[model samples]
Target chain A: MNTYIEGILILAGINLMAVLGLSLLTGFTGLFSFGHAGFMAIGGYTSAMLTVKFHWPFIPALLVGGLVAALFSAIIGKVTLNLKGDYFCIATLGFGEAIRLILDNVQYFGGARGWPGIPNYTNLWNVLGINLVAVLVLANLIRSRHGRNMIAIREEELASQIVGINVFKHKITSLMISASYAGIAGGLMAHYMTFLQPKMFSLVKSTELTIIVIFGGLGSISGSVLGALVLTALPEVLRSFSQWRLVCYGLAVIIIMISRPEGLLGGYELTPSSMKKLYNRLRLKKQAGKQGLEGGDIQ
Target chain B: MNILELSGLTKKFGGLTAVGNVDFKVKKDSITGLIGPNGAGKTTIFNLITGVYKVSEGKVIFCNKNITNKEPYQIAEIGITRTFQNIRLFKRLSVYENVLIACHKNASYSILDSILMMPKYKREEKQLKLQANELLEIMGLSDRRELIANNLPYGLQRRLEIARALALKPQLLLLDEPAAGMNPDETEQLMLLIDDVRKKFQLTVLIIEHHMDLVMGICEEIMVLNFGCKLAEGTPYDIQNNPKVIEAYLGVEG
Candidate 1:
């Protein structure tokens, strides 16, 4: 693959990992968080600063960045997670902007001039491995009893509460998890790009993540992966037409959503059950071909 | 002697007194029926017991523990679970998942176990599936295991609510208007199910119901409330003939 194309794919995979976490927070927990980009910023800048300022190892710095983002989210979540409905959205929006402004002005984090000379430790293999880990962790979480309860809370908080669910605790925990994932993605991203800027983690980045989650089915996992890929590649695919690309992008999203509002897959999950059926069918076909070849040899 | 006691239970929303210092006691393992007119505080008592709302003033003791100010989930942890007047099942979830989600508190798998899908998690999951299936079978909903709770017909949905609450394995089960939305035939079946379940689970049941015949048929004892205060408390026969109960049920025919 071309280096530029490979670079884009790697970045897209990182963004996909971050958005899958966002999908769990917003799509499953009924939390519409605008602060996701803030987490990404936290992760990217922390990892970048730690590596450049202290000369730490790549992996440890990245992990520390994730933990720092999780810690930040826990503190912010204590205040913002309680705000319901539109209020919650508004609070998260403000929080995201506040984080960006802090990063933009703070001298330690490049003070809007942007951080440079970070090593490009992230590559295709690294991004793929991280995405695999992200998918596995989230898939397990969704299949568990706690994930089921989170859906129940999303569907109806009052009923869940009466059924003995700790509403506040679960919401906060979920927010922290998503935040940590975003942070990790951000840290990986800074090392991959070999440069960082506070403006990279602005509201536009948050909206891009939101678009992927909303365009994906709210409660579906693979839907998020599909959404992220298509949305990321749609513009590139349209690049031959040059200026018409944005128009094509807008029209494509609008048409698809209007035609099938539940997203491409709706809420259908690619669970182990369906995967086993596919594997069985493929095995049967392959076995039949093998038998045919053996019979031909006898002839 | 009472296993659960409520003393001076009064709930006032501004000028309206919903429950007016009404005292009641629930004997151990007894099915007590609370009946009254539309606005009576029967449901309010269930809410108070479950801690949906803080009491304006009252003392609620369950099994020698003061649970007057306990949080809702705390109330459930202490072995009390209740259904709503309106059917409140997790509608979007499958019937089996609904019951499994309720049994989450009792689940033995740790968060790490779930995240890792270790041997212990898989074993517990199998056990959870079995337990959910048994509960669904008891409620005559096993065949509809994969059906979403909301898609079930109204009567079945109400039963699903009961099934979900029963999954908690509560020592005390409170039912608020369980038969409200059921047809006459369904009501009879529900009455039977309620009695059999109470016995099978060894649960102490406190039911607030409006259907007089069904309540009279199944309830071992009766408590009558009117305008948020106890109008009468006795056996079914005693409650039926009491003038105060009659006045509460029907205007005095002087």
Candidate 2:
């Protein structure tokens, strides 16, 4: 495989890991956060520190990074998840910026100058391996009872509470899981680039992740995978336009939103069974119409 | 014995008192009705009972436990569940899924079990599915189990809401305007259904309704509210003959 193609695929895989987690928070649970990039930053820097300073193994360092991100998200969620709607969004935005600024002044991790000498542990195969695990775990989670509680909270908070769901507890659970995913993705990106800089995980990075989640279709894992792959590669594919590339990218996103406001799949899955169900529904509707015509002819 | 006891239960939204200091008791395995004219705070009383509103004064004791100031979900976990007046079904999901979501109250598996698909998860999940289907069948909604909740006709949507509430297996079930927007035939059927479910599930029900015939026909005891205050409490026949109840329903001559 071409190294350029391999790099893009690896980048796509990393983005997919983060997107999958966000899909649970934004898509299934209906909570939006703008500080996921901060989680990734924590994961990348912490894991990078372990590998560089403490000489930890690659996979264990990645796990530790994810754990730290989850812990940080739990604390943040306790404080901010109570804030409803746009206030919560603003709080997360502040969290992302705060993490970046704090890292900027921390001299031990090279601060704003960036950190180097990280191991190149994130290859395409390992990236693919981790993403597979992430998707399976996410898919299974959705199929379980706890997953339904989260979706209930998304649909109607008051109704969910009346049904005995602990909305706050589930929101925190979602934030922690999503943050851990972002953390692992950060760890991968850190190893892949062999360097780290707080600047790399900015508010822009967080927004980009959210855009991918919405563009992919909120409640479906397959949608996230497709969104991550297509969106990550879209800029590279549009490079022929040079200066006009970003302009085209923004226009494309606008067109998609305007045309199919629910995103690519509209909360529907891309499974063989789902496709069959759609086909059957269409056929049944047509049959009903035909029966109506026959009855009209008899009349 | 009284399953739920309310003493001077009051709720004031800023300056407006939605439910004034009032007392009521619902006997176990009985169907009780709370009826009032529009803006009489019947729903507000239900909210106060279900923890949707904080009590401005007095206490709510359920099954001998002082449940005042508990969170809504905590109140639910303590065997209290309710259906909204406006039909708050999970619109985007199927009827079965809506009931299954409510069945989460009975699921015993841990989050880790769910993520890993452990045996305990599978067992509990199978049981939940069975319970949801059984509840749907009981509600006469088994045939429409796969239909999205939003697509259900108005009456069935209301039924689905009740079915979902019952999935919590509550000791006390509160139904807010269950007969709202129903035709006479539907309202009649709901009265019978309420009676049947009360007997079948061994449930204690408190219903807020404007359907006088249904309330009068089914409720073992009735309470009337006027401008956020309880005006009458008695058997259906006694309430019908009560001068104060009649005055509340029909303006005093003048």
Candidate 3:
């Protein structure tokens, strides 16, 4: 593959990891967040520190990075998960910006100016490999009883509690898992670029991740995959438009939201059974047409 | 033995008292009915018992366990579950999936086991599916199992809510207006279904209903409340003949 193409693919894969985590929290659990970039920053910085300062291997450094992000989310979730709806979203936005400003003041990690000299260990093969594992684990989790409990909470909080589900605990669990995913994505991006900067994980970055999740279709993993691929490549594809690219992008997103608010997949998963159902409906329509012709249009 | 007891049970919403210093007991293996005029705090009492509302001043003792001030989910785990006045099924999920979600309480697999699809998870999942299917069949919802919950007719929605509540395997089942939206025929069917389920599951039921025939026909005992106070409590026949009950329903001459 061409180097440019490989780079875009690597970026898409990293974004998919973060989107997958956000999808679980937002799509399945019905919680919206604007602070996930904070998690990614923590993950990226933590892993970069391990690999640079301690000479840790790529995999272990990534794990520790994810752990730190999860820990951060746990603390934040404990305080803010109790807030309902938009309140929680605002709380997360505050948390994300707070992390960025704190990092700006810290001198050890090369404050405001940014950290350099990180290793570039991210590659196409490993990116694809990690994504495959992440997808597999998420698929299994969604199909399990625990996942069902999360969906139940999403659907109806009071009903879920009446049925014996611990809503707060499950929300915390979701936040931790999602934060770790964002963390891992940050870790990969850090190594891929061999640099670190708090600016890379700004509120805009967090908004972009959330936008990708919504654009893909909430509650559908396949939708997230397709969304990550298409949206990430869109700006590059529109390079010729230059200044008008962002305007076009904004217009396109507004149009999609208006036309298909549920998103590209709309919670309907792309599975063999669903495909078969569509095929069978078409066959039934054809059969009805045949019957009509044979009967010669009965009055 | 009493399955549940409430002493000095009270609930105040700001300056308004919805329920006040009331006491009641539900016996084991019995169908008890709570009937009152609208805004009489029947549903409020159910909420208090199930931990949806905190007690303003009272104690809820269940199976000799002091259950006051517990969270709703904890109360459920301790074997108490309820249905709402409004049908609150998971709207997007299919009927089978709805019951299956409730049956989640019965699963023994850990989160790691579930994610890994370990042998225990698979085994338990298969069993849970079978149990869910059987429950649906008993509810006469087997044919509609694939339909999304919100699309089901209002009557079926109520049945599904009951099924979801039962999936918790509670020793006490509180139904808040289970017969509210049902037609006469459906209400009759519901009475029979509730009785059959109680017998089969060996459950103690506490139901709030405006439908007097269904309540009087099935309740072994009855309690009436008015203005958050217990107007009367007795067997169905005594409650029927009580002058206070009659006066409460039809105001005395001025």
Give candidate 1's whole-model lDDT.
0.87
lDDT string, candidate 1, A1-299, tens digits: 89978877887898897898898898888899887899998988898888888998887898899889999999998987778788888887888899999888888767899888998788899788888888888889888877877888998787787778888888887888888889988998899888888788889899889878878778888888888888988888889999999899889888878998987666777778978988999999999889989888644
What's the CA error at residue A150 for candidate 3, in Å?
Answer: 0.6
lDDT (Cα, tens digit) per residue for candidate 2, span B1-254: 99999999889899998888989999998889999899999888888888888889999999999999888999989999999899999999999999999988788898889888899999999999999999999999999999999999999999899899899899999999999899999998888888888888889999998988889888999999999999999999999999998898997888
Kindly list the per-residue Cα lDDT of model 3 for residues A1-299, writing each as its tens digit: 89999999999999998999999899889999999999999999999999999999999999899999999999999999999989999999999999999999899999999999998999999889989988888889989988888889989999999999999999999999999999999999999999889999999999999999899899888888988998888888888999999988888788888999998886877888989998999999999989999999967
TM-score of chain A of 3: 0.96
Show the colliding residue pairs in model 2.
none
Indicate the residue-level lDDT of A88 in model 1: 84
lDDT of 2 by residue, A1-299 (tens): 99999999999999999899899999999988888999999999989999999999999999999999999999999999988888988999999999999999899999999988888999999999999999989988888877888899899999998998889999999999999999999999999999899999899999999999999998989999999999999999999999999998899888998998999876889889999999999999999889989888644
Candidate 3 CAPRI category: high
lDDT of 1 by residue, B75-127 (tens): 88888999999888888889888888888777767667988998988988888
Colliding residue pairs in candidate 1: none
TM-score of chain B of 3: 0.97
lDDT of each: 0.87, 0.92, 0.92
What ranges in model 2 sit over 4 Å off? A278-299
The pairs that clash in candidate 3 are none
- Model 1, residue B10: displacement in angstroms? 2.4
Q: Judging by TM-score against the true structure, name the best candidate.
A: 3
